[model samples]
Target: MIYHGIRLKAKAGVTQEQIEETLESMRNQGRAIPAVKSFVVGRDFGGDFDCGAVFVIEDLDGYGEYLTHPAHAHTDRVGMPLVEKFDSYDITDDDDPQMGAKIADLHRRRYQSDPELAALVSKQP
Candidate 1:
């Protein structure tokens, strides 16, 4: 499995509700794609200066499917116009063991510590 972490920041002056709605719609659209296993969208809760979303995709191939999907193209047409960036990482025991462990620990300390995210992570297969 591969985890594609995407971060998207809406244009200035855009409301959080609008961003959330657009992302929800995008996730729905993503579900129709063949390769996508699951989609999770959430707002950045770290601080006030940041207005962005995080998505955890199950597979890199699915993530590619999403990029080329018509619905995603339509997303570029509608919504607050996001500035998107992504980091792709393969889930492997041998690659950067130390760094991967640190990142996993951080994720646990941050999102997993929260009841909602903890539940979400726990539910993942």
Candidate 2:
């Protein structure tokens, strides 16, 4: 399995609610894409990071499809108005379970330095 993490910083003055709504819309539309196995979206309210979304896809081909898919294009169109800066990472490992745990740990460590993110980490299951 492959994981795609998209970190988004909302444009100045954009509300968290708007970001959530856009993400939800993307989730709704992303369902049609066969390559995407799972999707999760989260918003960061108190730090430099504002919002982010994660996609679990079958392979690099799926990632490519996601970039060119119509739903994705629509998502980009909608999201562009709300995003200031966006970055993405492609993650993979031989073991899916281990990879997931590692990803969580990575996020935990990345966020641990920031008090706001540390609080967010404490809230995760």
Candidate 3:
């Protein structure tokens, strides 16, 4: 499985309620996307970010589906503006040496296809 994760730090003055809403939105994205095998949305304890989420997908195809899902876009639209810092990474148990490059390519194509997502990410600190 591929575990795609994101870490987020809320902007200054962002209310607790808004943070909760964002967290719930992350959970909603996982729930709405069929390609997601499982997911986690929770606070970060000892890191630069305040919160984080991880979505487990079966393979690259499922990862692509998760990346482009409407619910994922909706979550980004609602959550990104409140994020002060953002970091994303992927961990996979696949043995292929090229797996990392392949995963990066998936994200590159996603950004090329969705300019709005690229723009949203560019705004992060």
Candidate 4:
């Protein structure tokens, strides 16, 4: 299984509610897509981006199908207006489901000493 994470910040003046609504819509629409094994979306309280979404797909082909899904296209077209900029990450280790978390924790610990990161987290709303 492959895990994909999308980090995004909402456009100026966009509310958290709208961001969550858009995420909920994606989750609802994913019900029909066979490649989506799991989906999660939310704000990252102490992270770099304002909000993010995660999707668990079986493989590259599955991820490709997800990206091309009509529902996904529609959501990107419509919802992107509310997004400022987004970054993506994909992690896979064949069968280890815990790889994503381990990798994230490794990065977190590595960067924990950066004063700028502390400032960024402290400045969050």
Candidate 5:
């Protein structure tokens, strides 16, 4: 399984209501995506970030599906603007040495296909 995790810090002056809305959107994505075997979305305690989320997928194909899901895009569009800082990482049990490169390629292709999404990511501050 691949456990994809994200940590984020909200921008200064971002209201609690807005943060909740984004968190709810993330919760919805976790529930709505078929590729997500399990998920968690909550505040980050011992980290520099303010919040974090993790999604577990069975395989690389499932990870791709989770990333491309409409709900996932919705969360990004609605949540990214409120983000001050963001980081993501993946932990997988797969033994393939190329797995890391393959995952990075998935993100690269995604950004290439959707410039708007890339722009939103670039806007994070």
Candidate 6:
């Protein structure tokens, strides 16, 4: 299993509704890709990014398929331009129950701890 995690910031002036819609689109896009075990997207509030998504796939082959998926490109086309910038982290999905929690904790910690990076992703100036 593999974990593909992501965070996104809406372009300055993009509406909140638009951001949420884009996230949902991405979740749907992830679902359409072959071998995607589970996928989700959501808005992160009072935090670094405006939105985020996560995808779990079987392996590198599946991950590759997801990357080339038309739905992914289409969602990217719709969502990317609407965001100032974004960040991502990928890790080998560990079978240990604690590993997933650890990875998720690290993701949140990075967001909560990094301001400059967040600003950069938000396209400040």
Model 4: lDDT of residue 12? 86
**Candidate 3 ranges beyond 4 A from true positions:** none
Backbone N/Cα/C clashes per model = 0, 0, 0, 0, 0, 0
CA deviation > 4 Å runs, candidate 5: none
TM-score of 6: 0.69
lDDT of 5 by residue, 10-102 (tens): 999999999899989989988999999999999998888888899999998998898889999999999899999999999999999999999
Model 2, 74-117: lDDT tens digits are: 66666766767767676885566566565555445544644653
CA shift of 6, model 6, Å? 1.2
Q: Candidate 6: which stretches are off by over 4 Å?
A: 94-125
TM-score of 2: 0.64
Report, for every candidate in turn, its global Cα lDDT versus the true structure: 0.50, 0.67, 0.92, 0.68, 0.92, 0.70
Q: Residue 28's C-alpha lDDT in candidate 3?
A: 94
RMSD of 4: 10.2
- Poorest 10 consecutive residues by lDDT, candidate 3: 116-125
My TM-score estimates for the predictions, one after another, are 0.49, 0.64, 0.95, 0.66, 0.97, 0.69
What lDDT tens digits, residue by residue, belong to model 6 across residues 28-97? 8776887789987887666678778889877656766666577865666677677776777777845676
Clashing pairs in 3: none
How far in Å is the alpha carbon of 125 misplaced in model 2? Answer: 32
Better of 1 and 6 by lDDT: 6
Q: Rank the models by TM-score, top first.
A: 5, 3, 6, 4, 2, 1
Where does candidate 1 stray beyond 4 Å? 47-61, 79-125
| TM-score leader | 5
Candidate 3 TM-score, true structure as reference: 0.95
lDDT per residue for candidate 3 within 6-120, as digits (tens), equals: 9999999999999999999899988999999999999987888899999999999999999899898888998999998899999999999999999999889988999988998
